[model samples]
Target: MRRKEDVVRGVAAGIAMAATAPYLTLKLLWLTGSHVGARDPKALDSLWTVNLLTFGMDATALALALSFVRPWGRRAPAGLVAFPMWVATGLLGTILVAVPTDALASLVLGPEHRTPDQPHLDDTIADWVFTLVYGGFGVQGLSLMTAFVLYARRRWAGLLRSRIGDLPDSPTRNVQRAFACVAALVALAVAGVRAYWAAGGEVGLPIHWVEQRTRSIATMDAAMAAMAVAATVATLVLVFRIGPGRRLRGPLTVAWLGAGSLFGWGGYQLVAFGTETTVKDLPSATPGLMNLVQAGQFTAGVLVLAVGAMALTERAVQREQPSSRAALSGTEPPRDLAAR
Candidate 1:
């Protein structure tokens, strides 16, 4: 077969990259007080900090997008490709799916119930600013995920041939199932908090930041918890071989991505929360709420991470079949070669 290049996919990735430009530009504009997309002057205290973190995320997405068409991406270290992709899938997956629902709820329930608003969390950006930023994130996530699928399929087509139910029986499988069960339970609890918060209920462990930025934290908590729930459920279903047998690749993919994203998002939040912020110094007389969320999230992350590691390891060490053995027979196939 003649080696080919995916020009169409490359174009798609390029378009996604272009969409991010305006969002990043607007974020930079906030620092200069251009207020291009704002109804009010920026009020978020950690403007630079938030922008800096988001800038890195966009840059990583851009790099992943470029890798879809470039030679280096195919050759990039697996960890390099995996880490960012996992994060993108985890964070953006829920947001992309929920944005419209959230907007609808916000419209119907009224602005007061949209999310628990903090003292000044969103005073910095206008509604349009978020539309652009989140829109860009959604696009970038979809594009990167597409690119990765193509890249991974081209690179390791044989590895994916096996389905979830076909996973070999081993101690690792049992361990993974245990992890999944615990993760599912934790995710369920977290999801309750999220659902409550999203519904405009005050249920989180009261902290100064939660009180100040109730809506923002609530939104995040709700979203993260929900995503974790989906991931853990998918993982457990696959682990137990409940519905789909070895034939179902779709649930397997969901389990993999959901679990990975759950861990990635959990780890991201744990680190972000652990880090000292400007809010730490503010004076507050309210007795701090017993915040188990941070610890719970971290624990859930560790379990999910363990589960993912076990699954990936199992996939890696599975016995190779004839087709895969032949494909790996010392000849480098063309970069764009499709699996037989």
Candidate 2:
């Protein structure tokens, strides 16, 4: 029964993660447009809607994931803490940085015409606020990643001697470990990009030194996206191959699916971002791609939520099934023995 519950929780978490895709894509589009200043008003409005929806989905998913945490477990508090911290950073970015910056740019340049090359109002303040917000986001991302990694490790370790048995220290494990390492490296690279941007360093370091540092961040973004996809695939494969119990099968499958969706969305963003810049040249391809990305991100987020719900439902069902079976058999055992 406990095994079943674990499966459910794992699936739920995966679904919740998937639900973020559409919103993420939309945000990416808006960001791409903001860089090129070619996005239509309608697209901008749509992006905002997607953003809000994504946030709501994220909150729900986080709540669902939190419910699975055991009271005495180390991961419980970490998961709980990480969710709010992530929310805080997101709010800080949207309210203090993104919103204000957009408003100031619109007010100063007049909404009819704005471009990245043009100077706008509140640039310095926006930059500073964005830097701080990004830093906060980085912290939250790192913390959550660490917590998940620890949780995964502990859970797998605990199952080592079970029926499914310990995984051999083989090439596959090595590959999975390598994927994990790459994911960590990607995260660190993103952090480094953010830090450089915050410090007003030039982007495109060795490629196009003349471009602002933000341009370099784009490459890092692409790398991160790729790594995210790889990590998702690797984790899913690992879980599916090594996870124990028929009861856990469903939840783990859901988790695997949800993770795959997230990976797809992330990969899409990378391609979209590159396409918008290289092929479409900002504002032109940005709106459409952004909308697509946002929708994908949102859909992913919903899927993640659904996964979480399914996991929770599975757990509840498993918990009840035993009692139901016992009742059906008219097996009201001795209280002490039954409790054990």
Range of the 10 consecutive residues with the lowest summed lDDT in candidate 2: 158-167
Quote the lDDT for 312 in model 1. 62
lDDT of 2 by residue, 29-108 (tens): 55455432322455455355444554554454345345335444443553354334333322222232333444565677
Note the residue pairs that clash in candidate 1: 116-214, 116-215, 117-215, 118-212, 118-213, 119-212, 194-222
Per-candidate alpha-carbon RMSD to the true structure: 4.9, 13.6
lDDT of each: 0.64, 0.40
Query: Over 4 Å off in model 1, which ranges?
Result: 1-5, 28-45, 106-122, 205-222, 277-291, 320-340
Positional deviation of residue 113's Cα in model 1 after best superposition, in angstroms: 8.3
Largest TM-score belongs to which candidate? Answer: 1
